[model samples]
Target: MNRSKPKAPAPDEPLPVEIVDAHTHLDACGAKDAADVTAMLDRAAAVGVGRVVTVANDLTAARWAAEAATWDERVFAAVAVHPTRTAVFSEQDRAVVAELAGRDRVVAVGETGLDFYWDYSPPAAQEEAFRWHIDLAKRVGKPLMIHDRDAHEDIWRVLEAEGPPETVVFHCFSGDLEFARRCVDRGYVLSLAGTVTFRNARALREAAVHIPTYQLLVETDAPFLTPHPFRGRPGEPYCAAYTLRDLAQLRGADVAELGAAVAANAQRVFRLPAVTARELRGREG
Candidate 1:
């Protein structure tokens, strides 16, 4: 049976707003070409997701994401091969990531980190790749976007061994409260995604409270992990709004404050420019 296509956004004049999505993947989102990206951005902007860090797990996707970032002011790119894609890394891979790090439109060095959930790569290979990506982040003076999954101990060990990153953001954080405290102590940023809205995400919710407000971030990880209300559906960057709203309620802060905090956290972590639609369009020009 054919699945229904994702509903495209209605054409509406873009509005001015201040928002940011800490994580996204443009190449894998099924939006091909400039017009597709324009529509996706329109949909995100309509819901106040004004800025997004489009992450790519390989050189091809990284290049595409960087080009996409150039297409719109709000879109910034994160370049790194994911844990599962460790085999793709080579000496030239490091050089390319270093080069991408220098681009103005490129933000962080990630969606990198440990993911033992599916050990497609040998554990040693994953560790090596994670270290390499972390080194890239250090070399470029950018934050490291981590993707830890069921390998918390190993992740901590590697980070400690490699020396702590200046800016460490746990994208799609899934650690327990103790781990949250450890991350907080290290001044690492904990980014919550759609999964936090799940009824069974007790550990995530508990960890959320323990993290300092300024240290918290929200993401979509979209094209995956759609939150509770939309769970079982394909996720998208625009759905980050729902996650943000749920987080604010959990934290007992106003949604406006939540937005401001997460947006600030994103800017701090990604070093993204203060992107308004007008500013973004100017960049596109």
Candidate 2:
């Protein structure tokens, strides 16, 4: 099935208020060094996406993400072996992820959890790895970022069983209203991505409308899940501006107001420093 490379969306106006991309993948977006990493974040910062938490889905990405975060003050890292890649997950792998997860720039232990949508890893292996990441997050006192896909019930079940970390962020949250409510009620932060902008994502929009400001966040999940009108395009951290506008419209909230809240929530959950956003804005001007 050969297909053309998706077009990139043209940049939108920078938001009036700054925001953080709660999760994204600088490495997967084709960044390979300090210069590449800086270029990406520069594009994002130019559009008011002042900071981003680049997440890892495997050991290779985990190492890249940790180092990439240090390339720029605005980039942070989340390291984990994704559930789909957990088939070969071992004590050795856990040790490596743990070491990376402990880095000061690594703010969360994740993109971990079950993804029944793909058979890359058996359910048992996924569960084991998820539990290990959960414990690591707790031990290191960092938030746990999840990648739930068609395994919502068991996702909650596992989190419950392990007594979740102090903060849990559902990265690229795909749940409908009911599940969103459950997550919100449990005090989990929902990091909505470009999916919320899709015309077909009715239920996700419904969930977005009800999420309290304090418990809500936004992300690009890019180089994938680009927002509507540009749904088929490759997304970037800068695309957070588009999603934020659409999300604000859906929730009937002012764009700047919602952006502020989303930014605040990302900082609180990821424990990212707030000073940089202001400094970034000053430089962008």
Candidate 3:
């Protein structure tokens, strides 16, 4: 495996409409403070990505993500202990995450769900945390952002048993057509990342076609899953523009229409403030 840092892909042409990176990590994308946040959002805004929901997978990152959201109007935060990190998740940690999740700009309680792919945390511990986060999302009245990986059935089982909050987002959705139908049927928003752009992602592309516009979302999942032709390259929020275009093409929808739909979906799913297309194109930020 190449241990070298992946270089960023060259910027793609700006999309004709607007988009929001429904899931990303500003910290991992090189944002450290307000200035860095401004600069990063600018880079994203330059290419039609007007907003992003920076997610946290741990206590410290949850704090950073919450604070980062306050730094920029275009940035939002999603706070939760990722399922993989649930082994050591404690009461104090839960307190802080709960406080952060209730903040005005902390739009979701998430990046939390089952991840059986890694044994960093036992299944029992993960389920316990997942249930707590689900309850927190309901209490805080925020959307639930899920990080389902190799645990789709279990994720669904937990969600059904817990009686999911009003809204749920399957971040970086990695399910097949059948699963996609199930999620959409239950009114869950599926946030697709750049994984759909891979050459071997034919199944994903086919699944994308069946999803309704209202239930669709797009993201970069940046610093990872950089779209094809730049597969190994580092991605930033701006890359959501590339992913949006490709998704639109794959779904056989007009780029502008799909962009508008997904942008609307993001705004609603995350309960984000309005981001007018004019402001984004004019670079008003």
State which candidate has the highest TM-score: 2
Task: Report lDDT (Cα) of residue 271, candidate 3.
Answer: 74
Candidate 1, residues 1-285, lDDT tens digits: the string is 998865532322322335687898866777777888878887887777888889988788887887888886668889888898885578988787778877888888888887888858778888899998888888888889999999999999999999966999999999989999999899999988889989899988888877898898888888888887777677667888888878878878788877877788788778766556546666668
Residue pairs with colliding backbones in model 1 are: 73-280
Candidate structures ordered by TM-score, highest first: 2, 3, 1
User: Ranking by lDDT, best first?
Assistant: 2, 3, 1
| Residue 266 in candidate 3, Cα distance off native in Å | 1.0
Question: Cα deviation in Å at residue 116, candidate 1?
Answer: 0.5
Cα displacement (angstroms), candidate 1, residue 154, comes to 0.5
Better of 1 and 2 by TM-score: 2
Question: Local error of candidate 3 at 125, Å?
Answer: 0.7
Q: What are the RMSDs of all candidates, in order?
A: 3.0, 1.7, 2.0
In candidate 1, where is summed lDDT lowest over 10 consecutive residues?
8-17
Residue-by-residue lDDT tens digits, candidate 3, 1-285 = 858776798777888876889999999988899999999888888788888899998988999999999888888899999999999888999999999999999999998999999999999999999999999999999999999999999999999999999999999899999999999999999999999988698778878889888999999888788887788888899999889888888888899999989998888887776756346446865
Candidate 2 lDDT score at position 190? 92
Give the C-alpha miss distance for residue 70 in model 3, angstroms: 1.2
TM-score on alpha carbons, each prediction: 0.91, 0.96, 0.95
